[model samples]
Target: MAAVTLICRPAGVLPKLSGTCSPVLLAAGPVTVQHRKIHHAVVPKGKGGRSSSSGVAATVFGGTGFLGRYVVNRLGRMGSQVVIPHRCDQYDLMYLRPMGDLGQIIFTEWDARDKESIKRAISHSNVVINLVGREWETSVAKAIVNAIKDPDANGKTYALVGPNRYLLHDLVEYIYALSHRPYLAYPLPRPLYHLIARFFEMNPFEPWTTRDKVDRFHTTDMKYPDLPGLEDLGIIPSSIEQKAIETLRRHRRYRYLDAEIGETKPAKTVSY
Candidate 1:
């Protein structure tokens, strides 16, 4: 399950720390705002929208990932201040600034493997949403931000799964087909995959088939039961089919040449 950390603070002026320490300003580039104080009460000020204050200072741990970007967008539009921790090029994350009002999005560089760096990234946040996964969708982000604002969701867990599921092998083939590539691959035995993973660990350029990932392919299920989901947060989940073509089109063999209307067969989807 994806873990979301919420540290509740009372409304009004925050008490100063025991010893005198210089206040750390959370700003990116030239964008600046008054020093932020921790608050949980949704004392919304201004006439709403981006310029207003939602009283939420969120540190999105995986802000550069697929789902995190959308979550940041929604949070920005709703007037919430977001702290984005990134290790990638600072330029890559600049596009996210316009999503919120000026100074609403703050970027801090942090290494994920280091505990101290992670602590610094989330130091000023009242909420921390961890969407640290490769496979994600827009609906998941919407649901997450919605949950963050809902007082009832303070300690609840919400499962964010897509509307449909497909076998890994079938999904890979469909993606290749979208890219106009011939599919001629077979899954190797589990033991062989483990051996290959060990070899690739030492290789400079690691491929997608890592041992941990291979283990996940067999262990994780897309559709899980007995948990709250996106619908509970008033969100209708989007299907992967809705975005696959748009997402994979760039990888098409020829950039200008479009595929015939029905060239690729649709992968079988399991509706949950």
Candidate 2:
């Protein structure tokens, strides 16, 4: 009879494997595999606290004004505690009082024109939003420009309208200047939207498509002094502002202003 040879295979270990394996083998009872999962608690660098989700803090300036009020409302709705510094008292803040109840409004007294006040405001806030524009008939342009440039220089000194036409030219210039800053400015995220709302009223024409009508109505309602009755005149629908805000939300882009202090590097060069 020919001699018979037997090849023995290992019982536990597999011979050769290349691709991924499911149900990895292990010794039977009470096997403890050590796994290290590094969980890094990223703390925001500055005084502005980290967001639980994005880990960033949001700060809003002029949080009591018309646009600011809307911004603060949106921020609060997003569960962000917005810091609003104003020189006026509670009675003066009547418009903003509703926001206070939202539990996201923090009110403090600080003059935007004063550097000390601004510095203080910026200290606790991660983002700095400048919504203090001149609505009165004075040197609003110069005031806003100085505030943007100096970050200090208190007292409302800019003239609203004059040979300067500050609202048109200076406003655009200041916005441009702010765009150059390292940190994102308040209105920069959605500047065109704010500009159109702040500057003009909406008017829609008939025979327009529903999308066009919605767009016209949305743009028009962003301005203050709501005109629901105007819908009858074919200007804008009553829900224009709400619709625009919803549109902005759907895009994950916010038009409100917030600040990140110290994160802003000084401008190397500024041009008029």
Candidate 3:
């Protein structure tokens, strides 16, 4: 009977086997099992806490703004590593350090107009949170933050209007009421409105109240019925009325302590 001997060895060039092999076994060559690369999803470490690692690395643009600070604070408490990009002075960013653990919060200088700086700021992050509220509605900051965590919000643009939409004139009137001031609305002719807008443009330091802004008083931007909104993200839109008194409390003519706060009439809402 012919007996075939097989020498099973690890794949690479390793030292010869210690034991003496039979002539039949020596005839057989070494056999190897190939290795494969394995990938893994990031898993959070330790109990969910500020010091613990949540395994989320996020880059936050405009992290010093009103809405941005709140977003960064929430992200930090969840143990997410946050990268704040800013063009402000180093001193201006000092207060933000305490928002996260010792090494969890990172700050990098970035300019919105500089593409390379923007890329570098977000290069190491797996998530990017932009709090650019220039054209965004600041009242919807809470909704925006919640939307960021929802996977359904991915690749979707959302309109962040409040629960009730009000005309600009009505909003101003509401603010005037909160401040205990009288409001007078005078309709300007189309030609006069354009002339005033031109005059405002010519002012070196244009006043806060501009004609363009005044135009929005009676005008409403057309809403897109096909677009998604705060309601779509499982967030019940918050009414500005709820937060108005507290926000405008200090702006009252009388000091907050001296003033007896009274109920103000709610602004008229326009149904979309």
Of models 1 and 3, which has the larger TM-score? 1
Tell me the TM-score of each prediction against the true structure.
0.71, 0.31, 0.63
Give the alpha carbon lDDT tens digit for every residue of 1-272 in model 2.
Answer: 00001111111122332222111111112212212221121121223322221111234565666556665554444334456788666887766645433444667788656878755554433234455531222122122222222212221122122221122323433433333332333443344655455444344533323433334323311222222122221223222222223333333324322332223332232122
User: All candidates: CA RMSD in angstroms?
Assistant: 7.7, 28.5, 18.5
User: Per-model C-alpha lDDT, please?
Assistant: 0.66, 0.34, 0.60
Q: Which ten residues in a row have the lowest lDDT in candidate 3?
A: 19-28
Using lDDT as the measure, name the better of candidate 1 and candidate 2.
1
Model 1: ten consecutive residues of lowest lDDT: 19-28
lDDT of 1: 0.66
* lDDT digits (tens) for residues 6-89 of candidate 3: 232211111332222111010113422222221111135668778876655667777888767876787788777788998788
Model 3 residue-pair collision total: 0
**Model 2 TM-score?**
0.31
For candidate 3, list the clashing residue pairs, or say none: none
